[model samples]
Target: MGKIRIGVIGCGSIAKHRHLPEYAANNEVEIVALCDKVEERAAELAKEYGARSYKDYEELLKSDDIDAVSVCTPNYLHAPISIAALAAGKHVLCEKPMAISEEEAQQMITAAENNNRKLMIAHNQRFVPSHVRAREIIESGEAGKIYSFRTSFGHGGPEGWSADGKDSWFFKKEQAFIGAMGDLGVHKTDLLRYLLGEEFTEVAALVETSAKKGSTVDDSAVCVLKTESGIIGTLAASWSYVAKEDNSTIIYGEKAILRLEEDPAYSLIVQYQTGETVKYELGGIQTNESGGQSNSLVVDHFIDSIRQDTEPAISGAEGLKSLRVVLAALKSNETKKFAEI
Candidate 1:
């Protein structure tokens, strides 16, 4: 209603680097509570935001002062925390890779539906300026008859991005579930669905712990996905990009190939088969490797959805569908065959 009362459920790196700061800056939101298993982390962010700190998330959810919460907790806790918050009558903005399984994800969606509260997944890549523009071009038939694509997202590792650094739970299999596939691959999964406007029907994957020593979960994965439209693409996610990060996508169409975030100078470029190329200087992507500016476009959109009393752009059902694609990839890795999504 009046300046949405916001509570942050995790005080780790995402909360530090993105959620907390972004929420604090939003005029439509007021940071009312902060929570983390680490008391000091919660207290530190609470002190700065003029909010209460809680070691227990249930306490934060119990407070009527909060109208909504951003669930930035680890992968294992996403569904539980978001469902709890929703059941407590709080709108939820959950971090990506919605949950460990499609069933868990569905439960989270059901919770939101039962509570009549808004639920938005923080798939921030869709908010990137160049990506938004690329969607426009593709939809306009400029990138005609898109038949193939290759998209990748990679960086040093979660240790460099998480607030807990190398000691972060991100590497732990039990806590983080699927590693790079969960952390980075899902973003591309959702992004491709957004760009190609199709759902992945089947996938074949090689999930491996090719890099990183501490974690038992996979550190890298290469998946071949065939969308409902019969469009095929390679989706690669890795935590071993020691040289640099590559958050680029090439959408191949009959007329031209649209390259996104491949070059730093220009965020998007279209190379036509007619021996012509067009480059646009849209802003770059914000990744641990790239080191760029990123706004809380996802957060802002969530708030807008709340105020307007409408469904979020990235609703629970939408998130569930994307997560299913990821689960299918994991299954493919195990089965050594194409897995149906």
Candidate 2:
């Protein structure tokens, strides 16, 4: 249980901007290896971190030096690489939209269980201070029974943010599986589940590729999600927000309406029906615009979980469940009907 020797797969934007920097920041982590199909990409980070680089991730997984890994690959590779890593007896912190399908997600969970290695998903929204506080408030019954909510995550596109720029794999349906729904929608899907503490049982969706010019995958999507408890909400994910970003969530409760990331100053605000307003001055949620700041905290918590021998905040099972919602939404879009999870 000394410092966790970490191997990072995929030196993409999520790795370059978030995972690499965050892993470096964690004192309990010693970033030991870097891997990407693009050799230069892996080597650059290896040189920067004073670690070994491998173009083939399988080779990196074979290394005895690494005790854990951050699977930062594209949507298609998330499950395969994670299963291989878990089989190699290394703990994993896979980036989200955990897998393309729920079956793959289940395989990941099973692999982690069989290997007795921790499997955590990089659902960083759960770590946002506003979200954490909101969960606490809702749990305290200060917000009362949550009846309905609408949460959205949108931006211009992934061109500016992805490691590959305009020609990023994000635009390729084969590599990314789904578009905005995979990139942004799943974040809200995971966040809503965290906030409501309920499992989404059914989904009806309107998935579209109307805005973006080149991608075959969806550019905009609006999914109506209904939980087991009959709690309903609208989840919107888009790459078509050319004017501005709208990464906000509004929850309607019996007592008050809790608004998250709605204002610049107050990250969280609650309005009671009794004509009272309470604003929390917790810092902003790290948006794609603000860059990935809270990502370090995500790495920190993962390392802490390893050190403490505890389960991660977002376990593989929970991540799989979230993936089911997303997959169901995609199904609903395809079938033109409600999809059951």
What is the TM-score (0 to 1) of candidate 1? 0.98
Superposition error at 157 for model 1 (Å): 0.4
lDDT of 2 by residue, 237-286 (tens): 99999978988999999999999998989999999989999999988777
Candidate 1, residues 1-341: lDDT per residue as tens digits?
A: 58999999999888888887778778988898999999999998899889999999999899988999999999999999999999999999999889999889999999999999999999999899889999999999987899999999998898888887888888998999989999999999999999998888999999999788868999899999998889998999999988889899999999999999999899999999899999999877887743444774888899999999999989999999889988999999999999998
**Candidate 2: misplaced stretches above 4 Å?**
291-296
Clashing pairs in 2: none
Model 2 poorest 10 in a row by lDDT: 287-296
> How high is the CA lDDT of each candidate model?
0.91, 0.91
lDDT of 1: 0.91
Global local distance difference test of model 2: 0.91
**Number of colliding residue pairs in each model:** 0, 0
